[model samples]
Target: MKITISVEQPTGDFQKKLLALLADHADDIEPDATWTKERAERLYLALPTNARRIVKEAADRGGYVSADDLRSGEDSSLRGHSAAIKRAVDRGARDGWWPATLQSPVQAQGPGFGKVVGYLIPEYLVEVFQHAANKPSRDW
Candidate 1:
């Protein structure tokens, strides 16, 4: 049997959920076509600097990064600029540039249970995000 989904565009939240589901269950899902570096390059050029940076860092680490990681250090680029980072991430996810989780905190075993956090992005999109960094930054 074959199934089809028809929508002009999936909403940002919907896309994020879909991507997360896919990432979490990658072993169960298979694509009809293989993902290629060319396709990755095509997608990476359109992402914002913040998104690119996050992707690059996460890719370098191990394919997953939390918001706390980005903002942990005093000299971190994301330090004191979380709002902008969130916006950039949201935009990128909305546009299907990459997959990211919602900015929310997860409770730990002890201490600071209310810490707000960022979502996790998949490592596959790292190449695209990296390519975006090489592009010149511009303002309108």
Candidate 2:
């Protein structure tokens, strides 16, 4: 059987939810194609800088990165970028760059969102997010 869904230039939250439903169901049909590079790229560009860094690191680490692992000599804030990290998906959804219901590229692991121990990028999105994160940004 085959199904065809056509919406005329969908927009708004309802549209977002509907699109998300379709994408989620894609997991059952063909999970690998759910997170395409183009979609990841669009959402990646819409994310904040810190959020992008977190995603890049997760991609590099095969879809899971501890927030503590992100700290470096120059950057001492080792608790992970909570504000930016938490807002990653919302920002993308609000901007209409991606579906609001889509799973986050960076999923924080901790106690009830109180403290993030780490971030997990979906296995399917690992390479897609990596490609998006590595793409050169506008140097203007």
Write down the RMSD of all candidates, one decimal each.
Answer: 9.6, 5.8
TM-score to true structure, per model: 0.35, 0.64
Residue pairs of candidate 1 with colliding backbone atoms: 44-128
Kindly give the stretch of ten consecutive residues in candidate 1 with the minimal lDDT sum.
102-111
Q: RMSD, model 1, all Cα superposed?
A: 9.6
Which ranges in model 2 have alpha carbons more than 4 Å from their true place? 1-33, 73-75, 78-88, 138-140
Best by TM-score: 2
Best by lDDT: 2
- Against the reference, the lDDT scores of all candidates come to 0.48, 0.71
Off by over 4 Å in 1: 1-34, 72-140
RMSD of 2: 5.8
